[model samples]
Structures are given as structure tokens and as C-alpha cells.
Target: MAAKDDLGRVGEQRAAAYLSDRGYDVLDRNWRCPAGEVDIVASRAGLLCVVEVKTRTSLRFGHPFEALDDRKVRRLWHLAHAWIDAHPGRAVHSRVRLEAIGIIGPDPRSGMLEHLVDLR
Candidate 1:
């Protein structure tokens, strides 16, 4: 894989581990369709979370979360619904939420991880 792709995979793995540590049950990773892709799908406390993970090696470009703009957010929302539709057996009680996990630096093991919940 390309360096950037590998970095993103590492970041996603880190994000999954972080969520797991926090008591969230990770259901899926890299869930995709014609609409778009969701980095992670998890459930916790009756909330269905659709996660978008952004990873960067440095701040020279910008914070990883900066990539999730209005357009991207809309796409994520659609993707979340698509995921739900595809997985009818999954039960969601509270509601579906958009989340973002940002990783900065190459080593996700020690890199800075910022998780932003309920993105608009």
C-alpha cells in the first residue's frame, strides 16, 4: 500500500483500539458503498456511531479533523444511513451520530489522537 494508505490504516487501528478501550463495540471498519465510506461503525450506550478517521504525519498541512468539512459531513451522514439500511439486524436506540477520530504523526502507538464526537 501507499505510505498515506498505510498511515490511515494504522490510524484506524488505533482509533478502533481507543474505542474498544472506552467500552464501545466496534462493528465495522472501512464500510463503503457507492455513496462513500465510513471509517468505523460502533455502538455504545444505545448509540450508533459512524466514525470518520483522518490521519496526518504533521501539522504542516493542518489538523487531521480539518479535512471533515460540510460536504464530507453530509456524505458521512448519508453513508451512515446506508450502513444502517444494509445492516437491518443492528439495533439502534438513542440515535445515530457522526464522529471523527484524528491522528497526527506516523506512530499511532504514540501519536496524538483527537476524537470529536457528534459532528455537525
Candidate 2:
């Protein structure tokens, strides 16, 4: 696998741990469907959250979340809907939240993770 892929995986694991520590119940990691891929799917305070994780060695270019442009947001929305459909029991009256997580450091395992929840 490419180094970026490893960073992404590690970033995701960090995101899960971060969320878990914050009282969110994680339902899925790397959730994918025809629409797109959701890095993390979790529930908190009766709301469903779709997280997009971005990991980089540094912010020299820009913040990791900056990569998730409008197109990505739309795709994430579709992916969230697909996830909802897959789990009927968890969809009713639930709200969709778009979150962005950024990890930056020399290595994925030791990177600093920053989570920005409810982007949309």
C-alpha cells in the first residue's frame, strides 16, 4: 500500500479513538457504497455522523480538511444516505452530520488528529 493509504488508515483509527473518548458510538469505519466512501460513521446524542478523515505529513499545502471540496461533500452526502438505508433501524428520525478529521505528523501513528464535526 502507498504511504498515504497508511496515513489515512492510521488517521481513521485515531478518529475512532477520539470519538469513542467523546462518548460517540462508532458504527462503522471505512464505510463504502456505490455513492462513495465514508471514513467514519458514528452516532452521538441521537444523531448520525459521517466523518471524512484527511491525513498528511504536514500542513505545508493546507489543512487536510481543505481537500474535501464541494464535490467531495456531495459524495459524502450520498454515501451517508446509502449508509442510512443499509441500517434501517438506525435511520429513523436521525440527522446527518458531515465531519472532517485532520491528522498531521511525521508518521500516521504519532500524528496529531484534529476533528471538525458537523461540517454540513
Model 2: per-residue Cα lDDT over 48-101, one tens digit each: 888888889998998898898898888888898899889898666447788888
Top-TM-score structure, candidate number: 1
User: How well is each residue in 1-120 modelled by candidate 1, as lDDT tens digits?
Assistant: 898888889889999999999999999999889987889999989999999998888899999878989999999989988999899898454699999998887687679999998899
Whole-model Cα lDDT per candidate?
Answer: 0.89, 0.84
User: Of the candidates shown, which would achieve the greatest lDDT relative to the real structure?
Assistant: 1
TM-score of 2: 0.91
Please count the clashing residue pairs in each candidate, in the order shown: 0, 0
Taking all chains together, each candidate's TM-score versus the true structure is 0.96, 0.91
Q: What is the lDDT of residue 6 in candidate 1?
A: 86
Task: Check candidate 2 and list the clashing pairs.
Answer: none
